[model samples]
Target: MGYGKRALGGVSALALLAWAGAVHAQDEVTQVEELTVTARRQTENLQDVPAAVSAFGANSLYEDQVETVGDLQSHVPNLSLHVGDASNAVVYIRGVGQIDSISFNDPGVGVYLDDVYMGRVQGSFLDVIDPQQIEVLRGPRGTLYGRNTIGGALKFTSARPTNEVEGYLDATLGNYDDRRFKAVLGGPIASDVLLGKVAFAASRRDGYTKNLLTGEDDGDKDTIAGRISLLFRPTSDFSAYLTLDASRNSPDASRTPHRETPIYSVNTGALRPVIADPDVVEATYNDLEKLKTRGAALTLQYDRGPFTFKSITAYREMEYRTHLDLDSSPDESFGIYDFEDQDQTSQELQVLYKGERLSAVAGLFYFKENDETFAGLVGPDFFVILPGPTYFPFPANTSGLRLAENTSAAAYAQLDYKLTDRASVTVGARYTYEEKWTDNRGEWFDPAVAPSAEDMERLFRTGAGFNVTGFEAEEDWSSFTPKVAFNYQLSDDVLTYVSASKGFKSGGFNGRNTAAAQSFDPETQWSYEAGLKTELAERRVRLNLAAFYQDYKNLQLSRFAADPATGNFVAVFDNAGRANMYGLETELTAVVTPKFRIEANGAYLHSEYDEYIDGGVDISDQRHLVNAPKWSGRLSASYDLDLGDAGELTFTGGVSYRSKTYLTVSSSEVLAQDGYALLDASVVWSQPGGPWSVVVSGRNLTDERYREHAFDLTDSPGVQLGYYGAPRTYSVNVRYRF
Candidate 1:
């Protein structure tokens, strides 16, 4: 069936809500639930916050089937997530984000786990476990969220330990031999003085993409994760919380790149004929990937009168290894092996005060990070192979090692003052200083042609291959960011606010450069935003709207291209001169009746580069911003059916849509993703006042095929690759509570 017809099915779900309204009376209208959030480092009502924020509670998360952080993009407007590898994924909010993933590069969007910042993006694709709430803040959070928040921030708040004993166990079964198990428990450890909580999860699934050659799958998953939390209360005014988490993913199946046809060779200036069928997964080489992550954090707080003192300390580590076959053919034309290790430590101190007409927060922060990486590539020496019975031997090899260390210190303060009964103003600023040091080296060798007598010794040597070049460099940077906002209450049910903010990302040396260690300048943004939060229809409907405009300078950009000499891909970094971004977002929720609900949200964005010069030539007109879709939206509906003593049944269904998206800066038609839509539905049955429940869910019911990411190398090595999104899947879950 056509996709247009499938989309109409989603519209039919919303039409059902109209029929439900006819059966219910006007007096049966239900009120929307109130939400509380910590967007500005303080607890406040969601309607009272003077910014653009979207939040999902525990119940909402479950209904949406949010298994991992990547799933959140479907429900949030103007947000995108692209999986580049097994261990890492790139996140974009509005139209700003980083594209390259390496040891030295930082993420544009910041992610926090229980108020602790995560330093590396490698482990950001975490599994959601017993989460209490998740919040996505749009625009630049310069004052309260620290550095690298030019795009926005994502906050994950997990359920804390309580004095009461409570827990749940869940099991799931699905197609493709999918199996999952999860357990969570919380109770008092030592009377009223201590409390603890523990959670563990294990999941495995067979791959869905069939390999025509090996008769096996190529996209399987296997993972295990656990978390532990402890809370201590020594006095009425003092408390401490400690948390530890660990996860490991070692999947046997890996992604098989789908080769785009009609690719030409750079060596002989001729078309490279397709070696295998382009329809199915026919890669001749097997790929491997392993990732491990660990983290620990401690928070201490003391309350006295109208002030609260807080301290937080955290440490985290991650290790990843991968082997990839780039050519997708039996001929070892291009292969990649990479190893990465990263660790970080951080400390933060804060003081908060609340008064009759004035409220304020002040804090100091420190962070240190160390990381090392080893990358090697093997390919053909001559970059060409004759036809027939000739067997070409691979002789070219290149390797590199990169080591970097960074230290950062910052101080920030924000204050909110009320000038009248319904009017207030907020002002805040932060100053950050950072120092970075890097050591990079590379070597190139051909066993039969180079001086290296032993091929094994050359492969094992540290810092050996792009002509044996090495460099060491150190640099420091400082920035001061600030924000101001004015808020006013139009009535008891309406609020309006306007704000201006500035944010910046630190600069760093490129870790993959074969010659001199090249450096890129920092990027900065100035943003202006206006928002309105309102409750209408006698408190039965809620609507929120926001508009934003951002001006950016020294925009950092990364590009990957194949090198004909070694037949390997190389990444290069540079600064785009200027850019502008503007967007509009709106969210609406309506409780039509006591047992029916409908929700809708959408975003419209426009982005363009003001100036871009590469190799002393202007290229601004040909480049497009990556991960920026012109339009995105979602629509959903849910209904409840009460069966008296039997129990209750809830039904939910939704569809998410995205316009055309560019995967690279060049705006190449071969790497752009067309408009697409996905449909999901779920049904749940629960026993009233009981501890048992069952849920049946289906995702991508329309079976739409979409591209999540793509790599364009048609000019140099003449290879274009595409990575597809997941196919249709279904599962059934059972849960027991105590």
Candidate 2:
């Protein structure tokens, strides 16, 4: 809760909005429009695009109730979505990411759909019921987005199935036992030759953390989804579209709650009281996580009346499995059990051309991944005897295994030129190639002898049998990234920009707990950005501001140790020696009088560590940059009256804040969370020609206890473990349209 007190509270909220100079007349009475984006590959207008993007159409995520993609970290701007435990999640932007949860590893933000390419990270936690837009391409998009992008890229677009018939349906009920459902259905099966759509969604929840040693209930969840599409238009030069999507996630019974331990008794000065074990239903450290995803896509279009051609083909498959309980200490002698499984495949090809000022794009990408894991060390086998006697034993066999394979290919291009009438310029490039291979098979068993030929030749000699060992290697890499941007339009709703970019992420093999075949390099970035997009006053306000600086190289770091010769406990993956990040982002919107509206967003980051090395000591890089958060903000408001004959009545509210982060970036003994502000309110009542609608929401209206990641243990400094956030809840929704 201290980064100089959230950078002096964001500089006193920008000096109270510059002493309220009517805040530019609240963007000149809210006329703000124009915000189309494709991030430099056509379709401009996000202040003409020079990078540092952020968009969320689909009616502003259904008026900001944003149901997934982890709710866009409460209105993005420096984004974050840590959420570990139960299938883990780590998505930091600006300060990079990945803390370890191996699955052909690679994520520092990169997720696409509609241009397909979702290579794990649980496929970016789906469930957004249907989208027509969602783009968040900030910094380093590696020239037209081809590799990892350091910390950027999240795109999704879906909504195409028209030739008449429309669709809608939504339902929800909440407060812990929550339930949700969604539906969509589209038109024509053969009116001018085919067009169709289908969509479905389901959700169920029942836990909200409360396993104080098993008093039961601890964040449970379940989900299901489906999608289908088809479209074919013949004549006037070609058109085609096909899509299929699927999802399932069943396994999440989140837990990690324990605190209460105090005792003092030296024969007389006594004080002791400790109890916790409400019939332990589950949580000797719990585990559960199962996931599934499927995909297929095809899009083709051609126009020939002055050039217009496009093609997109995609195939994706993802499967995930998790069972973990890496000790949150419910004391089953401090448990440990873990598992992982993954599969991936991808291919992309693109082409685009638009005239009337020049626009061009080109692409080819292919990816493949096969990951398999069976991490080991699952509890109980005990022995302990004391008091003038000694005996300590516990060993029941096989404790390690990891296998991996990864492959990649890429080529990309972009161009945009419109040197007059508001000037514009963009150029891009991308070329990538990657390969990785790993195999580590080491197992030990001796509950009292049975295997020995020198322990089976030290478990097939690759790193020759554990205990402070290392290496089982194979690696390959190649790279090229380039970008440039410039835009200017000093009128017609102003815009100005500047940019520079380069980003990439690819490098693998850690095979859990290191046996030292190390190999990690390919974490690069070089970004510099500047921006301003405005539409003030008479345009109903809309403003965007951006500033960035990045220069991070080979920064991957992941460490956790305890291997005084295989007492087993090692998780090492390293490559960190340079870092530097800077940021400032702002967004504002107003429609201040069309029945009232308002929006605000903010971010301010500043990271460090220009070189660090630990345990062979070097450490001095100012620390604290793991989950980066220096300041974050969000605000929202809405109102629409006029209920004559119950026609309309709407109200909405929002607030969000973040500051205080570091779940481990080589420690600062700081997990001081304590900067929380969340409030969401809603109410809607409508009726104006009947399609039906109703809404009632109340999320986290001051039921904040906040703690999303915190940890410490060096023999337990009073044992701290965390992950809690999600309290006040309430919901009721209904919608319909045929």
Candidate 3:
């Protein structure tokens, strides 16, 4: 059978298992455990909390070989990551996510590292290092998280230095010339006086894709990161900690070209003739990106027997620049482009208090960013194309500069009154005030000539004039969000709960304004969720299931159109739509036998735009939104075998699958990536008494070709390009505990 057929068959089989009461039977015999989470003001078991949440610890991440936050989508139901230009990633939960690419604004999903907010979307894709735990809280987290959490929040907690001295190093090498190295050390500095730790990691990978036009390597990647932390305990009542980190990334292009002809037919009159100009080929370009990020955080804690107080302050800065060839056609000269610079800085502070049954958290946040961009469309001189084309330049030069600032302050409190030992009702509310400002300037110039000083001044002044007339020319906004939840335990091994919450995304000015000035309103969402957690059969099995529905209003939509007068495309942001989403997520883990274990997780989503108006036409009630998928899931199994005196060997394998999805809101044409399942396997061997071990892993054993992202141009017919998923790869590593 073909790969597509096999994948479809597997999906059908899984669907049958889901519907034939097999999953229900498995849940009955699973034994769930108590999971502590801070989704509420006070610590409570995840099963007892009314909100929909998924939590993963260090051991689980290690077993899954997760290298980045993007990898979490496979393990968590109803979640996916969207890839876009300039390292801009959009995270979606239950079919709700923002589609804009501007970096200075907020995203539909919020991400927090050690309680410090990361305001920009581009920087959120940084590598994860030495994390103690990660929590994905689904639905509106308005009461505590505040803005830009219309979908949910991702919280990462890093491992801290301990009183005991400990350290470890890991090294790996794999197929396609991939190599990785990492080291970590931590210990007490002076008994209870101080503690410190340091961590460093580096990775390199050979290009996986071969450029058909240039025969050059693409998809290459390199990353390096380091962190230092210090903890001080002055007295039994108070303590403080400080941490600093830095990271650098240099990566090659990952863009793929659209096929000019159908793969099944050669002479179907569909293929466009390849351009023969070297300049065009060069302009069709591929380039590189270099990004650096630095951050520092300070945290203080105090305990007074019955109450605990904590305060955290943090600062972060990120710089990113890229040079890209936008046109993937064989003719390179026509589609070349470059991004000179983009940067952002943020500062935040948070304070909180916790007690037996009551807790409160408050914070202040500020962010600022400045971006300068230069781009040119290169082609042949006029004379090369037509007769008497003297001194006619084919390249068009365009440049833009933008400055943005955002500031906000918020306070929230939650009170839990235990009516009984097994039942509790929590009431929470949050209030937030915010302000935003932006300034943009743009100019179109003829780069061939060196304009006189006076001419340069004139051009700059004209650009400023355009900014005065086009931009929003002001800054400020305010909002308030609230939340409530209830929990009930049926027994020691089973719990059920429900919750309702509100979420918001801040409004921002439109950067492109060739058309009339348009103002956007903050998008809001109200979510309702219910879930059940159960454990059975001597604590050997666990099952978690949740269903949620959300109603969204004033959804921000971006529209791009060509200006007949300037012949340039203009983009504007407007609140032109509303949507509703409903979904089910289920996870199960079973230790069927002493030496064997299996896990199965899946998500099913249904979303629709109830009201959508574009260009004064109703395009509402669409079946699918761009970059949204209806079904995705993962399944895996592992076993441990005793090797006698040599110790033990552990083997693991898994497969992940995603169903077909559309690439546009209109859903006029389907990307139709026939569902694909990637096969992965790994093995680890270790000695009983030694501090040494070895591991080998392989992914995508079948090397399936699939599209990660896809889109078609508005003016072109059947002309589409997309980013392809990774190919087959393998890695081997040796590690030492001390």
Highest lDDT model number? 1
What tens-digit string does per-residue lDDT give for candidate 2 at 542-567? Answer: 66788888998878877555444433
C-alpha root-mean-square deviation, each candidate: 4.7, 24.1, 6.5
Give the number of the best model, judged by TM-score.
Answer: 1
User: Worst ten-residue run, lDDT, model 1?
Assistant: 1-10
**Each prediction's number of clashing residue pairs:** 6, 12, 16
Candidate 1 lDDT score at position 59: 67
lDDT of each prediction vs. the true structure?
0.78, 0.67, 0.64
Q: Give per-model TM-scores.
A: 0.92, 0.34, 0.85
Q: What tens-digit string does per-residue lDDT give for candidate 1 at 1-738?
A: 000001111123234344444555557777677778999888988899999988888767765657888887877778887566445768888888887667678888888999888877888877888898888888888788877888899899989988899999989999889999899999999997899999999999987677666788876788999999999998999999999999988888666666665443334445555534433565544467788999999999999998999999999999987766555544445556567899999999999998999999999999999998876665543253333312234356666778889988999999999989899999999998988999987777764443322342345454333468779999989989999999999998889999999988899998889579799888899999999998766666677788999998888888766544544456778898999999888777767677777777788889889999877887888888888888888887778899889898888888899999988766778768899988889888888779888889998899887777666655434566666777788999998988
lDDT of 3 by residue, 378-483 (tens): 3221101122211222344344445555666666666666668788777777677667766665554454431221232345535332322325355567677777
Better of 1 and 2 by lDDT: 1
Between prediction 2 and prediction 3, the one with superior lDDT is 2
- For model 2, state the Cα shift of residue 573 in Å: 16
